[model samples]
Target: MSRIEARIEDLGLALPAPMLPPGNFKLVNVYGGLAYISGHPAIDGSTVLVQGVVGRDLTVEEGYEAARLAALSIIASLKHELGDLDRVTSWLRAVGYVQSAPEFHDNAKVVNGFSDLIIEIWGEAGRHARSAPGQGPSPLDVPVIIDAIVAISE
Candidate 1:
């Protein structure tokens, strides 16, 4: 296995099969050494792992785990596109959306789940700019959605 893949296994994680876009949009776009990945929910195929509004039906910890799952889905897509996780040079940006209750305001904490995994897998290369936005509801009623931009070596 590649070093990155080993790291994922070391972390007790495995990438799921890449998800197909439910709509006409593409899952990944590569240009100028950057890979732009579309938003993905915490799902394995059509199985929604976690679904609920944060601070209401779900706790912040649950939301955090959901965000992590979303990030893993994005990574699976990246691997599918590049054919090798080791081709990743660096992470550029990540944007996480949290489906939240009106009183919920811990989006960043939830999104940390995604960021934490990236760092764990890629070390310094995983550090990147990030944004966590709260939304009323997410598609398919998922608790989290995550999208990423990554730098890759040709």
Candidate 2:
């Protein structure tokens, strides 16, 4: 296994199967040594693992898990595109959308789920700029959706 894959194993995390876009957009676009990954929900073969709005239907913890799942899907998609996790040099940025009640303001904390996992797997290379915006609702009513930009080596 590649070092990156070994790290994931050490964390007891397996990348989920990469998901195809439900719509017409491409799941990943590579250019200029960077990969732009589309937003992914916490889904596995059309099953939405975590749903509903935070602070209402789910707790902050559940939202965190959902974001983590979404990040895993993103990593899976990356692996599918590059054929190896070791190709990744660094994460550039990530944006997470949180389906939340109006009173739920801890959106950044929710997004940390993704960030934390990335750092855990890639060490310093996984650290990146991030934004977590809370929305009233999302497609399929999932609790979280995440997208990322990563730098990759040839």
Candidate 3:
């Protein structure tokens, strides 16, 4: 197993299968040592795992779990595309969209779920630049939708 996969095991978390995009876009595109992953929600295949607006239908902690679910799937997609998690040299960037109530603005906290998961598995390699979580209606009404850019080796 790859080193990162081993860390995942130690963390007692298993990555879900690579998630399929809800639309026609590619899940990930790789070129010049970078992989661009499309937006991934907390879903399994076509099933929505978490939906609703943060601080309204769901609490901040709930939103965090939703983002973690998306992050798990993101790692799965990276494994599927690159054939090994160890191929990732660094996580470049991530953008997360959070669906929130009009009065709730803790967007960054919500996206930390996704960021924290990656860091848990890959440590420093998972560190990356992330935009302040964007808030608005998401494509599937999921609490969180996240995409990432990763630097990888051949």
Q: How accurate is candidate 2 locally (lDDT)?
A: 0.89
| Cand. 3 TM to true fold | 0.95
- Residue 77, candidate 2: Cα error in Å is 0.4
Off by over 4 Å in 3: none
For TM-score, candidate 1 versus 3, the one ahead is 1
lDDT, candidate 2, 1-154, per-residue tens: 7899898888898888788789988898999999999989998756777889998998989888988899888888888889988999999999999999999999998899899999988889999999999998699999899988999999
lDDT of 3 by residue, 1-154 (tens): 9899999899998888788766778898998989999988887766788999998999889999999999988888888888988999999999988989889988899999999999888889889999756577877788998988999998
Candidates sorted by TM-score, best first: 1, 2, 3
Clashes of each: 0, 0, 0
- TM-score of candidate 1 to 2 decimals: 0.97
lDDT per residue for candidate 1 within 27-117, as digits (tens), equals 9899999999999998886677888998999998998899888888888888888999999999999999899999999999999999998
